[model samples]
Target: MKCKLVDVFTKQKMSGNGLTIFYDYDVLSQNKMLSLTQEMRQFESIFVSEVLSKSSVRAKIFTVEEELDFAGHPIIGLAGHLHEESGDVNPRTWQIVLNKKSVKVKTKKSGDYFYASMAQGKPEFISILSENDKHAVLRALNLTSENLADYPLEVISTGLPYLIVPIISGIEKARILLPNFEDLLANFGAKFVYIIDIGNFEGRTWDNLGAVEDIATGSAAGPTAAYLTKHQLASVNKPIIISQGRFLGRDSEIEAYVEAKDNVITNIWISGDVAKVANIDFV
Candidate 1:
């Protein structure tokens, strides 16, 4: 099988989040895909199969742990790769079908990199953490009320549900303390947690085990943008720049745009630049 390794959310190679993409992966079993993802050791891997058309394909995403119904970076990275392979300088649009939904991504080739953006559609305001749940989350993150911003800790989802924790400072000091962190999030209907430094426009997230911190989370960008716009911290219809992966030394940048009407968020878009790294042949 042939696969491509690419860096997402950064124009520079070796920076941003690394992704492994396999084409014609429909013949692989779920267990085989999981094993391959673990072998690659990338933060995530995507299996692309069933090319329905020149501009449409089916994809399945996997972390080192398990399969995901929908994710952000993989779709963008896949679209970027497709654009590059097409050898087209003009912008192209792709429809990526996942387990949960279909995402539309627009890809354009730049000087040496490709930029891709996906329409995440309307944001879902799942729930606001109750005072009791809020305290539990703060404790689990080694944070107190003083460490948080004035905005309420809320759960939001574009594709994956994320508990958006806005903090004022000490982002470097935050860590997941509980072993059952995933269970903790499940109690509040969140699949993951995204802690954002509201003032600096930086964010961080880890796996459920908290063993690995994600370099750049395209999945979280849409939710963070919606959270900011909902609270009036960011103006609607403006691009919000989010910086991530700095602590890991990868350094990635992701941009999000939120559009709203009557103070209700209507559309969310996440965009980033991708750099092609290398192609790998798996025997």
Candidate 2:
């Protein structure tokens, strides 16, 4: 099997989230894929199968624990890699079909760099966590109620579910001491919790399935931007820069563009630069 390791949401070689893309998707069974992801020990790995249509490809996303229906950084990284391998510097669009849905990803080459963007689906506002649940979440993070901002703690989804938490203070003041993620997820009905810095747009996400921390979460960025715009915190139809992965040293920058009309969000786009690391042949 051939694989490529790419860093997503950042152009720098050791920055952003590292993903391994397996080219021989059809040969691996579900259990084999899971074992490979666990063996790689990266945040996530992707298996790209044959093309589904003229420009659409089939792919599966998996973490060490389970397969994800949709994920952000992997899609972006894979798009850039595919374009690079095809030797096509021209701008092109491709659709990646996951278990739940298909997302359109666009890539364009400029000079030596490939810029990739994913068009996430319409934002889904699942629900708002209650005050009691919010307090419990804060406590789990070793934060108090005062650390929370005026905005509601919301469960939003572009593909996967995330609890968007708006912190009144900077991301520096935020800490992760999640003693029990299962309880929090059960209470909030979310797959993860995204703690956003209300001022700087920086975010930190902790998964319910015990992911220590995601270096750069491209999937969460779309819904986070939508949440800010819907509540008038961010300017609608404007580009918002989201910073993540700073604490763990692999800093990443994600660009989010959200369009809204009549107080309803219509579209969401998340983009980032990818850096190709190395290609490996594992038999």
Candidate 3:
């Protein structure tokens, strides 16, 4: 099997979140895909198969842990790779069908990078964390009430539900302090937690076990944008620039645009640049 490595959310190679994408991957089993994702040591990997047409394909995403219903960078990176393979200079849109839903991504070939934008659709405002749950989450994240911003720590989902923890400062000091952090979020209906620096629009998130910190989280960007717009911190219909991966030295920039009508968020779009890396062949 052959897989291609690409960096998402950055124009420069080796600067963004690295993703491994396997094309024509229907031959691989789910267990094998999971193993491959673990072997690659990437935050996530995407398998593309069942290409119905030039603009549509079936995709499955897997982390070192398990398969995901939907994700952000994987779809964007997969679309970028498809654009490169098309060898067309003009921009194109692709429909990537995942287990949960189908995502539409627009891809354009830039000078040295492929720019992809995904339509994450409407944001679902889930439940607000109660006072006690909030305290527990803050404890697990090693944060205190003082570190929080005036905004409410809420749960939001575009594809994956994330607990949006807004903080004014101390982003660098944040880390997962509990092994049951995932369980802690489960009680609040969150699959993961995104600790965001509202002052700087930067954010960070780690695996459930806190074993690894994600470089750039496109999955969380849509919710973060919605949270900002809902609180009137970000302008609706304007691009919100999110910064991430700086602490790990792989600086990445994600742009999110939120459209609202009558105080209701209608659409959320996440975009980033992708740089192609080397291809790997597995025996």
Cα lDDT tens digits for candidate 3, 1-283? 7689999999999899999998777888889999999998989999988888979999899999999999999988999999998999999999999987999999999998999999999999999988888888888888999999987889999999999999997898899999888888888889999998988899999889999899999999999999998888889989999999999999999999998888788889999999999888888
CA error at residue 279 for candidate 1, angstroms: 1.0
Candidate 1 on 1-283: residue-level lDDT in tens? 8899999999999999999999887789999999999998877899999889999999999999999998888888999999999998899999999997999999999999999999999999999988899999999998899999988899999999999999998799888999999999998889999999989899999998888889999899999999988887888988999999988999999999998888778889899999999999988
**lDDT tens readout by residue for model 2, 174-194:** 656665676677666688778
* Clash totals in order: 0, 0, 0
lDDT at residue 69 of model 3 (Cα atoms): 96
Clashing pairs in 1: none
lDDT of 3 at 90: 99
Clashes of 1: 0
Taking every candidate in turn, the Cα RMSD to the unseen true structure, in Å, is 0.9, 1.6, 0.9
Question: Which residue pairs collide in model 3, if any?
Answer: none
Clashes of 2: 0
